[model samples]
Target chain A: MHFHKYEKIWLIFGSGSLIVFLMVLGFAAFWKGTHPQSHIETIDPQNIEAHEAFQAENLGLHEVEDGKYIVNIVASAFNYDLGKDENGDIVKTIRVPKGSSVLFQITTRDVVHGFQVAGTNVNMMVEPGHISRFETVLKNNGEFTIVCNEYCGIGHHLMFGTVEVY
Target chain B: MSTKQLTFSKQESTLYMVFMHVTFVSLLIGGLMGLLQTLVRSGKYTLPFNIDYYTILTVHGVILGLVLTTFFIIGFQFSLLGKTVGISKKQLRAAWLSFWVMLVGTVMAAITILIGEASVLFTFYAPLQAHPAFYFGLAFVIIGSWIAAITNFRQLYVWKKANKGQKSPLLAFMVTINMAMWVIASLGVATAVLIQFIPWSLGYAETINVLLTRTLFWYFGHPLVYFWLLPAYMAWYAIIPKIIGGKLFSDSLARLAFILLLMFSIPVGFHHQLTEPGIDPTWKFIQVVLTFMVIIPSLMTAFSIFATFEITGRRKGYRGVFGWFRKLPWKDVRFLAPFIGMLAFIPGGAGGIINASHQMNSLIHNTIWVTGHFHLTAATTVILTFFGIAYWLIPHLTGRTLTAKLNRLGILQTIIWTVGMTIMSTSMHIQGLLGGPRRSNFSEYAGGEQVATWINYQLAQAIGGSILFIGIILMVYIFIQLAFFAPRGHEEYPIAEEESDALPTPKVLENWYLWVGLTIALILFAYTIPVIDIIKHSPPGSVPFSWPIGRS
Candidate 1:
């Protein structure tokens, strides 16, 4: 019950800092609409192709507007099914122009995986049966590697892709 | 109370010693696994004997994170109970049963992991299932801990009944609070294991509900860290003060912190699931708020610790603002090790706040920064405090003394550990900021430019880890010395007394019904709606995938 004068002062300083942190977090989450990659819609892991976004024709980048795009990806153990390019080659590196706003919509068929465009704020936990989504503008014209941060399986480290912004 | 009254009985000492023995063995094994992990990740050495990297990673996580911490905490808490409130013969017998059950379970699980059947990592997220025996073994471990928790509660309950109206001993009350939280929180994991994992892994069920199982795990997972933490807090609050020749700064304040931790730790597991899908962001935000509430108690603890040092030093005629800090016993390992633990928590606590910050979790969520954060918090702050306790506790129990020579060795060991962790954790944080992922084996990532940036940090981690392995070797040597080879003498079991002029601790602080009731209410409020939403709007369950990681 007895708080030394210094103890009280320390408590005030500590609590004040914590409160400031909470206020900033709240402003980002509630006011600025900053949330993690949580999408409420459930997709069937076994039958992902049945879902509109995950169908073969829709698995890669599609420009919804001049500078806005959505990339649908299906993550599996040891691989990211990033759809094919015009030359019928698997799209390992996604290319977009600088200043383009891209929304990555991803899900997994087996086990939990991670979708993180390294060195960017685009990170998400792609779980089975749920679509994880993160939208960010390609501000820097550089190649960002996409690595699976979650331990999906033995070849977890081998699972990586690239995003090039020109 | 006389020293004789507080001393553990011969049988009691043996029981606690068994736990200590298991703890040290785990430290060595787990420490080795960690060293190997760093070496492998450095992109220099490959694991020989066809040993998979994930297997060793699982070993490190399970042995250190689960086995070492659990055995040490339960054993240490039992000793606290025996010292503070006399444990009956019946309670002692039950404690032994708990120990055996836990040991058996640990062996079963350990063998399974060793033989390459359960490399699912310590978290063991379902759908990537392990062997059924692994699940069974983990279940037995939980049940065994339940026994220990029950014994602790009964020990304190008997004491309260006999000495009606008297407040319980501070350490005993703290032990009870921790046990109560453990029981309540572990129910989530226990349910997942018994009902979901066991059935699915055994092929009785065709598929496992992924989100449901994870929700249940994190329900227990967040509190799992606090379970490792509160015991260290126990030593910091009660024992460390006495070691420093000071009385407890405030009895009520310490009790209040424990109560608050119990309340806030459980309901906030959603913070871990923030980056995952299926869970609503609103629930995550709410739990994030609750997680921040838990920080209040830790902040209070920081203040109390500083105040205890300053007041004690001033009493010894130290004058300047920082003179009190200088007055602390730097040469004594008993004080020095835990002091370093306290120093580590400053950064560790800051990292935790950032990790739990709603959207900010994206910055380091699954990155090596999170790994660095915990190494500082659990591995440094908590483990170092345990070492500090061991320097005296082991000798005190074994009728031996921490010889001045061994004390010097302890100081050296502490320095080695500090240097090693600083280098390792610092590099981890830097690499994580540069987009390095955790829980992966060594990879060049096809020579990507960003991947190239992480190699130097990885090499630094390997160096740091090798040094840490050396520290572990020294610690184990010191443990062996203190347990058997130290000089035979009475090493005082220091328990600080409440200051004579301090205000009486409020009766409400001891009101278990009120506290536990509030704890339950908060957990329900935080969990119920989100949980229902997860199950109601559920995804189709998936069959097991054990090909790459686990044996069928």
Candidate 2:
């Protein structure tokens, strides 16, 4: 019903701090295109292998418009295919050229898993029957490891993939 | 009836005794599991048994997060209620019943977890289901808590009926806000568990919409943290100032904060789902904004609390800038523990801002940074306050004076806890920035070389975590020593008086129904679209897959 003068001042100062925080987040999401990956692509897990785009050979680096490179991945119980080797073996490295907008389109065959590249702001929950996608410019040149931060099963900790930025 | 007419009876003390015993035991078990997992996770040692990592992690999280905090808060609130508005014989009976039911539920759940049929962690959403007993046991615990909350509400209702025009005492009012919030918050997880998770675990369903369950879980999850923190806030409001020889800065401000917490905490669970799909980004952004709005109350709390320190410090012949800060009783464990808890919360609140942002959430969403942030928030602030509470409460319950030796141990426990938590959380935060994932035992991340840099931090966390275990063991011993065999003396329940005010608060502040109604409505407004879309877009029924971890 009543306020101490200092209490009222504190309330105002606290509210002002909040406004500043929200404004920075708003600026980044709306203006600077720095929002978390929300909309990119989707694929049902049950039919992922049969889907033409995710078939072994079709999963590598590809130009999807002008500067965008898409890496389609089908993650299962404990592993994700970063790309294919020369003999068609599943390689652990997801190689993308530097300064390119690379989109990681990831989905799981069973259970929920997280596709998180630890060093960069590239993370999403790869779910069963739904795809999780994130597109980010591979600005820094380094080898970044991707780990399944979500607890899927017993081997959750051993689940790691790599992003090689050149 | 006024304050003196409602002194806490011995029956209520026994109830406090029962609840606090549960808290300490749970704290002990949880701390042990936590210690083991930290070491194993560091790649420094193998888990002694054939038992694996996530199982230990699940036990650690559930025991500490759910069991310890719940039992302690419920137990502590009984004393609060008894002190403010006397608990009837009937209410005491109900409280005991609630305690037994909760204990049974905890045992049932613990059995399932120990047998390794429920390795799904605390946020075990649908599709990754646990044993049927695990879900059922958890539901029982919720129901037991619901019974306790309902009994509490009844006490408040009866108090209101008798004293029609009087403002509810601050302690009673604070407890009710948390209880009401808990009751409403539990529903979301209850629905997920009852209609979906339990049935799925029992083979009653073939598929489930993971998005719906996740949405529901976080709906409960975020508020659950507030529920944990509110008791600490209560201590800060009612007791901390008294310990420092001052009164609450403003009672109305404290109530305003709790009211805002009840309203805003539920609707903003979607902030946790920012990294996941199926929720619209616009809805996420809206929820994120609400999440930021929630920050105001905590910041106000920071200012109000620090102001008390200043006022008290000024009284003690300390004057001018930062001199007041120097006047705080740093040697008294009762003051020191909670004060340090509040200090840790400053960063905790700041880290939450990053987690709740759409732009920044991506950077730390699944990283150990999130883990580090929460450890500082709930684990540090809430646990440390509870430890401080134990210092006085155990003595009160047991009718003993905490001797000089035990008090020295108490102070050492607080200092050890702070040092360990600082090292552990700081390393976790930096490693998170370097992309170390939380909840993972990453012995090899993309093979050996890439993870080489993380080993030192991992070892640092292990060392810190080990020290924390020593602190827990010491605190538990002190609690036991105080409770069972210490010399008898009259112990006081710490409660502060407020400076003279207009006697009763404005009737509008006492309008509890309106505040709770708005809370429920906001929850509906925020959740309606996303929940509806989750059901509409996804196919039905997700079958439970058994966990692969070994039995204890």
The prediction achieving the highest TM-score against the true structure is: 1
Candidate 2 lDDT over A51-145, as tens digits, reads: 66678777766788776898888776687866677897877877777888988787777788888887888888877767677788889888888
- Candidate 1: list runs displaced more than 4 Å: B1-5, B550-552
Residues forming the 10-long window of minimal summed lDDT in candidate 1 chain B: B1-10
lDDT (Cα, 0-100) at B272 in candidate 1 = 89
DockQ score, prediction 2? 0.60
Q: Comparing to the true complex, what docking class would candidate 2 get?
A: medium
Q: Per-residue alpha-carbon lDDT of model 1 for A1-166, expressed as tens digits? A: 6677877788788888888988888888888888877888898899998889998878889999999999999999889988998888998889899999999999988889999999888999999888888898889988888999999878899999999999
Query: lDDT at B207 for candidate 2?
Result: 74
Write down the RMSD of all candidates, one decimal each: 1.2, 1.9
Q: Candidate 1, residues B462-542: lDDT per residue as tens digits?
A: 999999999999999999998989889999888998887778998999999999999999999999999999999998888
The residue-level lDDT of candidate 1 at A96 comes to 94
User: Residue A88 error for model 1, in Å?
Assistant: 1.6
Runs in model 2 deviating more than 4 A are A40-43, A64-67, B1-5, B501-504, B547-552
* Model 2: per-residue Cα lDDT over B326-346, one tens digit each: 878888888999988999998
- Residue A49 in candidate 1, Cα distance off native in Å: 0.4
